[model samples]
Target: MAHRKWIVWIRRAILLVLLGALVYHSTIVIQIIRFRTINPRMTALMRQRAREARARGQVPKRLQVWLPYERFSPHLVRAVLAGEDPRFFVHHGFDWDQIREAIQENLEEGEIVRGASTITQQLAKNLFLSTSRNPVRKLHEAVITVELEMLLGKRRILELYLNVIEWGDGIYGAEAAARHYFGRSAAQLTPEQAAFLAAIIPNPRETYNPARHPARVERRRRIIQRRMRHVLIPAPFRAASAKAAESAFAP
Candidate 1:
């Protein structure tokens, strides 16, 4: 009788856990749907940084001004795509080729080093998940990535990503980044200036001031510029309203 009771309790516990997971995932799906049209006020990373600043008794001044996809310069978009994910429009939520390459490299090096996260995965992590680099966090990130891609589509995904990605301490979005870095608007970002911004994305917080690391930033900027030449911005992400602006400022 005791053995049967123990088995019954174990089953009940498993069912409860499964139910919790279902509810949690359902919530995430709902949030993704809502975010399709509504811009998020703050993301997980933004909130985390705010908490850290509060703990240190420093006031966090988040500088983010939402600009529609068409208002941003095409140069900035191309530069970011070139530097971060050259295959952003080609893959689903995950880049299988990059993952395979990363796995092979890690095995050969005997350590996990290379990252194969697509822009979708990064957006999912930034929006809903913490910055923890554990297996569980990665699993959550993957699940969230699927939800985002399914609900938001590529255009919305890229729009949200460009608007939320951090460019410096408390500086968020392309507009804020452009102004802070070059005293210009996102729509006015030149190719070289945009490339510099793209280059600092990997180490945004530490290398916010490109002048501090001119050689490294310049080298990465040149690489992005070269890649941008070959990259074609898809119709979905192309700014319909920026043609006149581009022509007016054409060099």
Candidate 2:
């Protein structure tokens, strides 16, 4: 009798845990749906950074000014696409070719040398998840990525990504980064400047900072400029895309 009762309790506990997980994931889905219209005031990354700052006995500072899609410079858009995801327009939420390439590269290098996270995946992580790359978090990120792609569409995803990407210690968004770094608006950035900005995105706050590593940034900027000339911007950004951005869209 006691063994049967123990088994029943175990099943109930498992059911409760599953129910809780469903509720948690459902809440995230609702938030993602809301994001289709309402821009988030703060993202998961922003909130996490704030918490970290508080833990370190410092005030959390944020600098972000949302710019409409049209307000973003064509050079900036092209540069970002070139630097981050050339196949942004072709892929849904994940770039399988890049994933395979990255896996192969990592295997050859015997280390993680490249990442395959698409713009959609990156945006999903920024908006909803932690900085951790653990398998569980990655699974959740994948789910959220699909939800974002299904709900927000490509143009909206790109807009949100540009508006929320971390550029520096306290900086967020192209508008804020432009103002902080160059004393200009996002729409005013030149091609070279835009490429440089995109080049530093991987670790803009530290490692790849233009202020701290001008030579490295210049090298990356040059590479991105070359790529920008060979990549095509998607339909939503086509009207605003740079002349150099015209290229075959097939991936």
Candidate 3:
């Protein structure tokens, strides 16, 4: 009798867990479908940052300006592609090759120093999820990423990412980053400036911050500039980038 009761309890627990997962993912699907037409006014990271600032007794400041896809410079687009996701245009919502490489590197180094997230995955996490690396959050991010790809195309995804990604302590989006870092608009950023900004995307507040580590940022900027020549933005954007950038570096 006790054995049967134990099995019944286990079955009920499994059903409850499955039911909770269904409800969670169903809500995510509804939100993602709405994202097809609705531009997000704010993102999960913004809210998280605000709460953190409040807990620390520091006022939260946000700098963000939403611009349509065409308003940002093509050079910035190229630089971002070079620095963050070189195969963004080809991949769906994930990059298996990158995952394999990152896994191999982690094994060799005996540490987790690299990430394999695609731009689409990053956008999904920033838009709707927290920065935590917990398994539940990662699973939710995966679901959101798939839904985002199913609902929004590559161009729209890129535009939303460019507008929502955190570039600094209070800076969000290309326009705000440009204004804060270089005293210019997103549309007017030069290739080198754009490259510098892009190189800091992985960790804008510390490792690659120009204020704290200009030398590291500069090295990454040069590497990105070289990669920019080969990186291609998704259409309907033109390909006439980086060639003009070559002149900027001519000595």
Q: What's the TM-score of each model vs. the native?
A: 0.85, 0.86, 0.88
State the displacement of the C-alpha of residue 250, model 1, in Å, after optimal TM-score superposition: 12
- Poorest stretch of ten by lDDT in candidate 1: 241-250
Model 1: residues with Cα > 4 Å off, grouped in runs: 1-13, 100-115, 207-212, 241-251
Task: Extract clashing residue pairs from model 2.
Answer: none
All-Cα superposition RMSD per candidate? 4.0, 3.6, 3.2
Q: Per-residue lDDT for 9-40 in model 3, tens only? A: 99999999999989987887887777777878
Alpha-carbon shift of residue 59 in model 3 (angstroms)? 1.1
lDDT at residue 227 of model 2 (Cα atoms):
70
lDDT agreement of model 2 with the native: 0.83
lDDT tens per residue, model 2, 132-171 = 9799899889988888888887888999999999998879
Q: Each prediction's Cα lDDT score? A: 0.82, 0.83, 0.83
